[model samples]
Target: MNNVEITRAGLPDISRIVEIENNLFPDPWNEQAFRDVLFYYSNTFFTLKSDGDIVGFITAGIEDTSEVLYGHIMNLAVVPEYRKMGLGGRLMQRMEYEFIVSGAEGSQLEVRVSNGDAISFYKKLGYSQVMVIGGYYNNGEDAVLMMKWF
Candidate 1:
């Protein structure tokens, strides 16, 4: 972890990010989606590099509504080889810091209901389960909505 570097993701990083996404997720965001996000939320998109290779990444965006400004974490993934190395937590912390500085009142994300490990991870990060959305995923998996207020 000490040797890992966290930096804002660039256009050139999208292909690698898409690779990680496709490998880790049941339904991954395509290259175009990553590109759109990088274009629109560059500040909130980050990549973790170790030994000059991208090992993890997180993407977030500020959702401004009439009632509040919320940080919406869209996607997060770590290469299989890099899992459980505190890299994901580091990415979360970095994204949270950006949300705070960007005037977000809170942060939110959705995780698969069956993913207990991820749910516990979010809990450890101070997020509480707010609701469950049925058929949230393309494959009809229910999603647990989690939120944290800063």
Candidate 2:
């Protein structure tokens, strides 16, 4: 099996990451959004590469927008061809380590409520459902608010 390389998002890697983003999400981040990430954010974006190809990625940030600080996972996507492998978990474990490096002691994210497989995956990784968002996705799909403490 090929080894996966995980690192922070870098300058020359935006195009392939965008390709995966577009193919994975209906409301993908646009060009400016991506540029903002690559140019402006340093600690929030991380990518996983396999055989020098961008296969999966995870985006997270400090949840300072709320009253208290927390690590918040914004996005986690693995290309369909690469699913069923442990790449997603690996990417998440790396992101969590980075979040703790930045002084965050806990993390939170929302998962689509209907995605039982994803929910199981997160739970297996020690995440617990804390609540539910009524209309979390663009299509009004519900989402489960899950949190993990470091």
Please list the Cα RMSD from the true structure of every candidate, rounded to 1 decimal place: 1.0, 1.8
Q: Pick the candidate with the highest lDDT.
A: 1
Clashing pairs in 2: none
| lDDT: worst 10-residue window of model 1 | 78-87
Q: For model 2, what is the error of residue 3's alpha carbon versus the real structure, in angstroms, after optimal superposition?
A: 3.4
Alpha-carbon shift of residue 49 in model 1 (angstroms): 0.5
lDDT of each: 0.94, 0.84
Write candidate 2's Cα lDDT for 1-150 as tens digits. Answer: 387788888877778878888997776877667767666556878888888788888877786755656788878889988888888999888888878887787889998898898899999999999999999888899999999998
RMSD score of candidate 2 (Å):
1.8
How many clashing pairs does model 2 include?
0
lDDT of 1 by residue, 45-137 (tens): 999999778999999999999899999999999887888888889999999999999999999999999999999999999999999999999
Model 2 quality (TM-score): 0.89
